[model samples]
Target: MRSPKQDSAAFTQAPEAVFEAALGVLQNAGNMTLLAAHNGGRRLIARERPKMSNAKFLDIRVEGDAGAAQLHVTVGTDPRTPKAMLDGKANAKVLKNYVASVRGAVDESSPAPASPVADHCLQKKTEVPWADAGQDPEIELDGNIRAAYGL
Candidate 1:
């Protein structure tokens, strides 16, 4: 379930790069485990240490074009646990701290623009050797050979 407590920020970087920054921030936050990450979709889900008294989770979503990105973060507590109470003050503080940390980490570690060399590498294509080009690429063995080798 999505939390009502959410925050968002925009950056002058790619969505994928921002996603990586979010992962790093979560890791450094300690006790946060990445549950799911979709690089193509630019989304990440993480859970706080289950052992903690206040069990919580985070959902980070990224969207952007080639030049800019936006990150949305949602923080929520475990709905199944009856002990998890909704405290406005606590939730607000947690969300605030999380947003601040995420922003700081992204600003510090976001990937720089691709260099000319990197751009060239991304654009380049290589041709495979003719001998290996039209082959199955999988090794095939005869049943007799397998049996002889101890099938």
Candidate 2:
């Protein structure tokens, strides 16, 4: 029997938002289906049943109110599934991928206006004096390395 794998993460968005994003990411993932969703997206259950592969289960739960949330996730093969049918640590790997996908999904939907920090990155960089003048700034004015280094 394969043991369950679990992980959790925190996000800046609301619980509902994070839950929905996770659900969407799972939906886009191949061979996964939504088994159920309850608590207005605060709790969800999904299954991964690939052809000729071990079936896996996923559970996601979200907590917190507005503007802040925590997401908990679990992945595992069915207990009844025989050991021979189990794939080693596949659940853990899948859980890691799921968490990464959910993180990307939650963070992808940015607010309309760019934050100041992000806007700063989009601005053109200032030119350096040495590069603009095509000069080797590392060398001394007279190209004397010993004098520059006080050697």
Candidate 3:
């Protein structure tokens, strides 16, 4: 494990170099959906989570050698609709190839660097008041039930 200071330095330096290498690794993976990726060195570890559904979720992790990296990605399907996979018109084998192509693009190595200006940006916190949910009361009373209860 690296100290905080060491990690910070690794992240601040050339991050893209590592990612490019990892991209090479993923490009060779046979059949898998590109879920997420990670990249770093002795000092830092950067990871990215894939988007979910039309909005879904992708889980991924990577473990790299002192100079290399490893990755774990989980692919899921959407119940509401099939993504990437179309109707019968789409070939099943072609769909598999398509997913492989995307997985190849994922590089579990160095990630994109943060903008220097981001370090200087100030963040503000705000407090919000909570309100109770109001309930609606609009229903016709049953004459028979009302009569039974003499209401």
How would you encode candidate 1's per-residue C-alpha lDDT over 1-151 as one tens digit per residue?
3234688888898877777777677666657755545555666555565443455656678889879999898776644335445544444566787767767766774322321111000001222222222221111122122122121
- Record all residue pairs in model 1 with backbone atoms less than 3 Å apart, i.e. clashing: none
The ten-residue window of minimal lDDT in model 3 covers 1-10
Query: How far in Å is the alpha carbon of 56 misplaced in model 2?
Result: 0.5
How many backbone clashes can be found in candidate 1?
0
Best by lDDT: 2
TM-score of each: 0.62, 0.64, 0.24
Model 2, position 139: C-alpha lDDT score:
25
Candidate 2 C-alpha lDDT tens digits along 63-117: 8889899999888775445554356478887888888888878778421221111
Off by over 4 Å in 3: 1-53, 78-111, 114-151
List clash counts for every candidate, in order: 0, 0, 11
Model 2 is weakest, by summed lDDT over 10 consecutive residues, at 114-123
* Alpha-carbon lDDT, every model: 0.55, 0.61, 0.27
